[model samples]
Target: MSATEYARAVAFGHAFARRQAVRTVDVPGGFAVLDDEFDQVHDLNRLIGTGPVTAGELIAAADTVFGTAGLAYRQLTMDGPTGTELVAGLTDAGYRADRELLMAYHGGELPEGVPVSVVEPATLLDPAERAWRAEAPGLADGTYRQLARQRLRRPAELTRRLAVLGADGTPRAWCELYLSPDDRVAQIEDLLTLPAYRGHGYGSALVAAGVAQARTAGCDLTFLRVEADDGPVGLYRRLGFEPLGEARQFHRAAGGT
Candidate 1:
């Protein structure tokens, strides 16, 4: 795909993630999402879209909204125009910036290997909830397990949650396949394997499963995002995901709240 088309596809995935938030509010040039249930900035808080707004104005708007919501940290997703202005603005405001690559899968045959089973979000709920409760506390503060329960209960129609189970039927790894409402594009999200099972083929199996499902659902394109420094970028590339573009995020930790 052309650069323009790739960018648009990534934008669609961003919009999808934003819409799934627990709450959203309009800001100056975009929206602020609140999802305190999950620990990640992409899940918990987001500032999207800046359009033609000045950097100062955008920061002021973020301060107002996040301050009112009592949230200390937030991630601002930067596009071409807004990114240039916000990098300077955020630097002056004492925030840090991180870059992540948005990747896309060109249509073709999927690699074959370990089989992945498609499961209802609810089927994995019990173990997933348990895993979150056991794992989230050490990872971050706040009610992660509670939020995870809420997330599992609120699966969107466009989203397909799949998993690989162990001998005892415990979930070993899982991923989500999200098809755009227009059905022209899809995204493979949250492809994760438990730490104990990292070296196994579960992650690759999950990706293959999601990609196959996306094609079956009539989506011609698929996409995902990875941190620039993350090791999984190599795995994704081996699975046919190519780097299309990059987005930067500016964040301030929650001390202000």
Candidate 2:
């Protein structure tokens, strides 16, 4: 069958990971992304896809690769499951899966009536503090901060960061827009807003700014991926983004759980 838009977009994501991963090794169906520097950043330290291999072999390889690095866990990212056997096998093996939805912008107006500007990724730290506390209340203040910092550390030579700043000059909302090497695809990632600032229209404003930037770059496809049942799905739909695909990520947090 011909590849769906979602499949093409998934390929684009894997290509990006391969292009920037500090180290990569061929695995059964695809490869593993290994960046010890961001070991805790699961996306930077997980398997990128799956193929026609037995679940036991896949789990063993993943454990070895990650375990050898002292990461203590195995994680896998793949487009939605194709067969029940593998999915059932992995589930029985104790790997938990989470669904992530990908949506594509279908050309339209967005409520950017608010001001959103391109900003240094470093500048968002102030606004991100609230996120650290709200999202991971049990984590050490430093750990949450560290996680946020690590995300910004990703390869960004092809990215533009956008933010909506309050009158006091602190970011109320922010997101990252990444244009593909050929400028044909743009993926809006890491959209965030502080807990106390939720209703200020910052999210839509930031998205609008990102879409504008994508159009300016002549990117033919603009998309955003978020966890299923996430709050922003409705907002994205209202802004003209339609479902393109979904990814199912299997995670076994440190020590086979």
Candidate 3:
């Protein structure tokens, strides 16, 4: 795919993430309280709103539940580089910037003849689950277990779908697709490739699978964020994903009193 097309696909991925985040909110605690609906490529963080003080307070509260309890976490969204205070707040706490991504999309001919199958967690393989677990370092063990529980119990609240391509057996790589409440978009929740499987077009194939799922769900767009400094920016660039915006994160670890 050309750079333009790649960028567009990535943007679609981001939109999907945003919409899924908005839809999957559980209210009172889960997603609704955080109000991550507006998060975009330029502003990846999802924690913002009402008053500045309220926003900070909300972050602190989230720290207790999402952070400490490990049931969830926060992703703050800013238009560009964060302010000194924000940086200090995050650093003093424990949180630091994670994925700085170039967001882009337009939509057209995807990589030719990429095979895709969208399967739910129930239909997926344990190896695929392990691959995603290995990729998300920030995800706590409790949270990971809870995800499995939610999928088994409250399947609606958790949409765990995967995209696979390449050789029929053993598979190549897979991507997770999250379906939100509104059903407007599908979040490419997470993408994973076994260490040995990297660089073999598996990632792009996963991206294609996500797009197909999102469109099938009646969603118009999809989305995700990448580290601005990550070398793969070129890969995303070549794929058509462009820089749409930026976000900053702050965290305080247990050491902070």
**Ranking, lDDT, top scorer first:** 2, 1, 3
lDDT (C-alpha) at residue 75 in model 3: 51
Q: Quick one: RMSD of model 2?
A: 2.2
- Quote the positional error of residue 76 for candidate 3 in Å: 6.0
- Where does candidate 1 stray beyond 4 Å? 35-44, 81-85, 107-109, 123-141, 153-155
Clashing pairs in 2: none
User: What is the C-alpha local distance difference test score of candidate 1?
Assistant: 0.72
Worst 10 residues of 1 by lDDT: 146-155
lDDT of 3 at 63: 56
TM-score of each: 0.84, 0.91, 0.60
lDDT scores of the candidates, listed in order: 0.72, 0.78, 0.50
What ranking emerges by TM-score with the best candidate at the front? 2, 1, 3
User: What is the model-wide C-alpha lDDT for candidate 3?
Assistant: 0.50
Q: Which stretches of candidate 3 lie over 4 Å from their true place?
A: 1-81, 123-125, 132-160, 165-171, 179-184
